[model samples]
Target: MVFKRMLQALGVGGPSVDAVLTSPDCRPGGTLEGAVQILGGDHPVDVEYLAIGLLTRVEVESGDSEYHTDQEFHRQRLTGSFRLEPGARHDVPFTFPVPWQTPITEVYGQHLHGMTMGLSTELEVARAVDKSDLDPVAVHPLPAQERILDALLRLGFRFGRADVERGRVYGVEQELPFYQEIEFYPPPPFARGINQLELTFLPTPRRLQVVLELDKRGGLFTEGHDAFGSFDVDYATVDQVDWVAKLDGWLRQAAQRRGLLF
Candidate 1:
């Protein structure tokens, strides 16, 4: 019996946990269904609770510097206190709601470069916490978001990379503290005066807020600068608008006018 207990014990005689997701792909404002599988340790343990959360890498700006860190934005408890007998197994099912402001990690079927999102599972046993490895999750764009992205591609912009920044966007009602920036290289026609363009989407249930930022290229006698613009589209009429033309007009005006502010 002693040898059997020793053989069946988990690392350090503590319980082990594995969180499995039904599907790794989901959209913002959707639900992620999964179950936490727990295998008890060599001895009985009083499990305080089980929790799952959504985490992502966010760029934080400090005084004269910037760094990246994993931030857990939302969490849901799976259970209350329970007794876990030695070598016993427990499976707790959960339906975790994804925040409306969650960042997109994939476009179409391809994962966005420089972007990472995962589900973290933590179990509290007798005041001791055991965290499982992060389970990767893909957040796809909504219909309106997809239209905007496709419009940019149609306008001849090439995708560079994407990342989340730890700050609220000016002039936008934000429920989450972080926002994502999708970077793109300017098309050839506008490449002379503009170096790059960044796009941010702030979506609510009724409308989508789009923010555009352009990095202006410096001329021989002029210094480089940045310009910002924002607009909103009702979700119901997303398909009615001609996004390609709308975006093209804005891009042209931004490139031609050096000091334009919108």
Candidate 2:
């Protein structure tokens, strides 16, 4: 309680807030249930508002350089103005909806390197400054997402790292300002032609949109370049397709410089 309390805004005696999540793990399009526990300070104070949101680190490209910054993509207001008496505690329950395009931060119980997710609670006092609290959150992949990731592993792609970028795919439809890229090293078979592979998943309630990017190695006659491919899968038919064979074929085509339009 002491660590969760915000003592700077209202000095030694001010309202403090802590967001307690029932569970820190969830998938996209799911709901995160939690309670906002607010404890009054030594005196009565007017609360301006209470809110919670999903926060993540996003990489932003500026000119020729890129930087990372914290971004709150989704938010929910818990309550409006309220009055708090001395030493009074209030618990407000909330159900925060995770956006469909929210990035995945964990897979197979492992935290993806360079990726982070959190639920942030913000409390604004009428006359004092804003008090805030943050709790780490783990975003797991949907069933369809898991299938594709498993396919990549079966295809011998070693997981490299993952990151969220603050931009939209050139031809993909996205509801959020940022998207995630999971990087992997090519298998031995395709290592000579393909240097690296990157995967991005944009999922909805009914369908999952997948985008693939390949870093092609330079040949004696051609220069190194990148190859792109996009496709969709219906959630109802996710298990019908052989993702490993599909991905291997696509990678082979891209490695041969034939075509990546799938």
Candidate 3:
């Protein structure tokens, strides 16, 4: 009995945990469902809680260069105060709501390169905890989000890169501490007038606030600077509005209205 207790204390013959996600792909503001499977070894163990954390790897600017950092955006506790006997097996199922402001990891089923996101499971047993399993999660854009992206793509803008900044966008209501910026390289039409464009989306129950930042290229007589514009629209407008034409017009207006203070 002493040897058995020692083995259990060392976790040599204790419980093992595995979490399986129902689907690999999910949309922002959608539900993520999964199950945690636990298997007992040679002895019984008191399981305290089963927790799943949703984490995303983000890039942040530090002085001159950028660094990769991991952030846990959300978590869900599936079970608490459970006991597993020797040779016992149990499955704990859970469903969690993904925040509307969740960052997009993929565009149209294609994983954005260099984007790292996953769901990690932690099993709390007694006074010890173990984080032994991680599963990759794919987050796709919502319908309204896709509409805007499609419009930009059709407007001859190429995706540059995406990053989450620590600050909030000006003139927008946001719940999340950080906001996502999706930068785009300008095409021929706006190349001379603009250096780059940054897009940010703040979603609410009724509408989404779209913020556009235009980085203007400095000419021989002018200094380089940025121009900003924000608009709010309901989901219904996504289908009714000609977003491509509307966005193009906005860019052109920004270019002509140079040096105009926001």
Error of 1 at 4 (Å): 16
lDDT of each residue in 174-219, candidate 1, tens digit only: 8898999999997787687788899998888778899999998887
Rank all candidate structures by their lDDT, best first, as comma-separated numbers. Answer: 2, 1, 3
Instruction: Report the poorest 10 consecutive residues by lDDT, candidate 3.
Output: 124-133
State the lDDT of candidate 2 residue by residue for 1-262, as single tens digits: 6543455344568878999999999999999998999999887888889999999999999999999999999999999998989899999999999999999999999999999899999988875677799999999999999999999999888999999999899887799999999999987877877678999999988799999998877778878788889899789998999999988877777656643222
* Ranking, TM-score, top scorer first: 2, 1, 3
Full-model lDDT for every candidate: 0.87, 0.89, 0.81
Predictions: Cα RMSD each: 3.3, 4.2, 3.0
Model 3: per-residue Cα lDDT over 1-262, one tens digit each: 8876666677777788888888978877788897889888776778888888888876677899988788887888888878889989889888878887878889976766656778888877884344357888888888888888899999999998787776567777887777788889988878877789988887876787888999988879889888889898688767999999989888787778885332
If scored against the real structure, what TM-score would every candidate get?
Answer: 0.92, 0.93, 0.87
Q: Whose TM-score is higher: candidate 1's or candidate 3's?
A: 1
lDDT of 3: 0.81
Which candidate ranks first by lDDT, i.e. highest? 2
**Superposition-based RMSD of candidate 3 using all C-alpha atoms, in angstroms:** 3.0
